[model samples]
Target: MRGFLASSIGVTCAAALALPLTLPTASHAAPSPTREAVPGSTQSLALDPLETSPGSTSTRAAGAPQEQGLTRRDVRPFSLVGVVWDDPDAQLHGNVQVRTRTTNTTRWSTWQDVETHNDDAPDLDTPERAAGGLHGATAPLWVGDSDGVEVRVKAEEPEAERAARPATLPKGLRLELVDPGEEPPQGSRAEGADTGVIPALDKKQTEDELIQARGGKSAAAGSRPFIGPRPRIITRKGWGANEKLRERKLGYTKTVKAAFIHHSASGNNYRCSQAPSVIRSIYRYHVKSSGWRDIGYNFLVDKCGNIYEGRAGGVAKPVMGAHTLGFNTNSTGIAVLGTFGSSKPRAAAVKAIARLTAWKLGLYGANPRGSTYLKSGGSNLYRKGKNVRLKVISGHRDGFATECPGRRLYNKLGSARSSSAHLQGR
Candidate 1:
């Protein structure tokens, strides 16, 4: 079964770590829709199970079920795509890909792969998790500005003898089409009436934080790393977010002890002009369709190297986010806005990451190049309740059994950390 909404005003709407995390104070913001959300469309594609009946064309040998499951769906013009199957945590051992029509003419894009193993998520007991929302899902795929779309999911078979196919593919599959609206004119937020996400603090407040951080008096402890000066981050309001679709309150942990890195997994075909729309699309998808309180990452970086505030919590506070399963506690999740699996991460994107981390991590006195400890909440690699020590600036793959931040992008983490440390005066 599947659900779709087109250019409509409304719609619907991971991971764990042990070691009870203490939350800190929170601040919230409000924003109006930048443009009406792009019209929506929904699709459900039927997949052929592997090892067909005798005389049937099969992608796999007769007894191989792993190669059996496959599915795809086609939908009208939309900016973003998200896939949801029947179970939360149900693993689909396979590949997912999409190709789009770049022009009404015959021009078609080569197939693009969506990150399949996106298990990096917040702990189960969290509010978003308790809502019984997305247990398992593929990362959202962003195709360059396109009008037509299609997707395919194939079940993967492991080489090891011990690995076996589940009795069946996930029972239900749904595809969501999102139209992130047009880019707002530059400096739209300067108007008093601008409705994007509100800044967590006014200039006066931010100035005070800057003063405290520079003097190393914000959080004083021998073991505590010094907070670097706060970098300029575009607030949720700056991005023109719609506050109504999500629960408009802030959620926070006592302090951000770690910074988990991620790629939006939404493809690299977007223009900087389309960033706010991309964010809005992800925002609505995360809140309405995916059943989460808000966007999961604490901050988002664009390929153009622009930084946007993600989630509603004040940018200055320790807002808890639903990113990096088993390690969200005491951490901030920073997601770059496009897929990086097969492509190299943009240098601007990498620099934006370094600047953002240097400032945000500095607030808590964490060294971007150092390490932090977090317990596991049962990921593909970590058993529940296991104690894990991770780097202050780590990729999503370090904690979960998934290939996130992509190979090309993940390779750049070393540079990102070094740059961040340099920015923080480390």
Candidate 2:
């Protein structure tokens, strides 16, 4: 499935290491939704009238299996889209397809599938999950800049065994149109380049920054400590994140013991230069459309080997993220920015995963090639409080019963693990 969300009261709203980590103190700011203040905006539209299968005379009752969507219509210029519903626990058992017309041309693209199993979320019962206004959401889709869109969602039939009852579509479905907005102006921050990317750092330099960010503390002493050189990363500010869109207070965990890999499932039609825009779109979707506190992933790696900061918080800190559903407490999430169910992921992207995991996991003295146990908060795969053993670097499916990160990319985790461990000098 592909991933992609927007505005008028839309839906609301990942890491760490093991040194005697000096966790950042939690600070709160007044809750605010300054959507109009930012260049980017979301346009939330309620899904339109229901439709029946062609030639079928029967009408769909309020709770019956049904199809819902909007006719082709003009909308604010948006680069991404997704469908959301009122109940976060509701399952959308069906298909969601959309076609979009280019911003200025009469051209309309063929219908594309939006992944419906978006169960990859914060662990249940956590403060983030408890936050008000959460919703059931499909994976956001990156559709590029477009001014017109048409969408349809159809509920599938129940299997023969369960045929006694049909699947009913979720309630209050809404279409989220998101504009990532313009990229930040050149030279937006001292630490950022004109292209909005932060430069890579050598091992020593990274260690220094890591120490500085951690209140002048150093990692546990070792003659030959394992740590990888920091990869070049695009900061949230560099990518033009509207800080005001997310909740002011950042959440954190005690330590990061695992890294869950995911594919944004937002398709692979984007150019490398457009990645920042894609990140921004996903950020808005997660916050404005889905009602989460911030973007779900701790970090995002583009197909070109470029890494972008995901959820806000110091990159080196064990900032809590809303990535892996049941095991988010002690883990970080890294999403590669493209669908990889059948299409192979880029070599550069795979390498970036290795490089990033090596550095981030190493902070907690974790071996990417090793395994760790995380207690399940709750998920379809694991019961709440269950102790599950998983690799330090595992795919999204490892903790949740969903085909996330995608099959092609999930198959490459072994190689990424080996390379990451090697980079950490393990």
Candidate 3:
């Protein structure tokens, strides 16, 4: 029964494949000419000048002088032709005859036979055979003779690869390899190494170094770390013409215990180049328009797999942001940068989310094993009435009626939970 089912499916797929090629279109009625042949003794021919159809008139004079037995006057009616054969050892044999005429003079005819031999030829190589030959294989080709002179043709590599290779290092950057045990001379610092090391750096400098180091580690681990834009400290005194918006007080909360995950609902079309602008826009929209003090999410993940800090981190208390319904007081909401209900989040986003969640969970000292204050049984989590225990990584919809996270992304909550568990060594 299984074999019968498999055969039926295979036959259905085969029929689907055959349907497209068999279907006819208006363009199919008049097939475009690909190649053309002209009467000539020349070793090479240019088909672009040839007429598209027979009986097409040429603008050149009929009494033009002939070169290599080829002229507009003596040229035969050219037509597009395709040569096909069952075996690779197939020859293309044809003859071109030129006839000369003058007023009140006897017409003279001359013939030139172009015969291609169906045998192994060194120069006449096809791309498929040449490609195979690159990996230690020989390609056979059928050679042709034009006017008793052997004509050779061969395929060459694509133009892109033929271009010169660029230097490895950037213009100003030079790299040198050092031996395993090699060290700089005594009391001598390396060229690019920093000598004056401060015991402690300012808050901004410390944050910058930490972010840079984390970015380096993330690159090495094939993951991404959250790196926010340069901290633009807002003063208590408002700045600029939009003084009313700036004067608006930013909201605050007691503490953040958990985080809510959400999809942007709009597709993953946010440009990575404009990430900083997008972050600022989100903040303005949340604060000015949504009547919230700051961006709703604590962090945002972009499609190119970059994680950005949404809410500032060093505040003494958690700032209130709208992400979850009942759990907003304890949850530090994180909204990923795509419409997840329609599209599956990329692997990088998943990894970044895992790392960020693990870090946040550690900071809050939240226990994954402990019963989650948020309820878990719903279409958003499992299904209604399922009665699952609250895991550390729970969906926004797991606790409330709102579809804070989309269906496709909500499914990955389990994976996030597992990643958190693994990171926590639970």
Most accurate candidate by lDDT: 2
lDDT order, best first, reads 2, 1, 3
Q: Candidate 2 or 3, higher lDDT?
A: 2
Comparing 1 and 3 on TM-score, the stronger one: 1
TM-scores, all models, native as reference: 0.78, 0.88, 0.39
Cα RMSD (Å) per model?
8.4, 6.9, 31.1
The candidate scoring highest on TM-score is 2
Count backbone clashes in candidate 2. Answer: 20
1-426: candidate 2 lDDT, tens digit per residue: 000001111110011322226554353343353323348889999987666768864437533567789999999899999999999998888899999999999999999999998866776877777877889999999999899999999887546623566556799999999999887775654453333455676777556544544456556546445778777777776778888788887787778899999999899989988998999999999998888999999999999998888987656667788988888887899999999999999999999999999988877778999999999998888999999999999999999888998999999999999999888777
188-209, model 3: which lDDT tens digit per residue? Answer: 2211112111122233332333
- CA lDDT, candidate 2, residue 200: 71
Displacement of the residue 426 alpha carbon in candidate 2, Å: 1.4
The CA lDDT of each predicted structure is 0.66, 0.81, 0.37
**TM value for model 3:** 0.39
Q: lDDT at 231 for candidate 1?
A: 50
Better of 1 and 3 by lDDT: 1
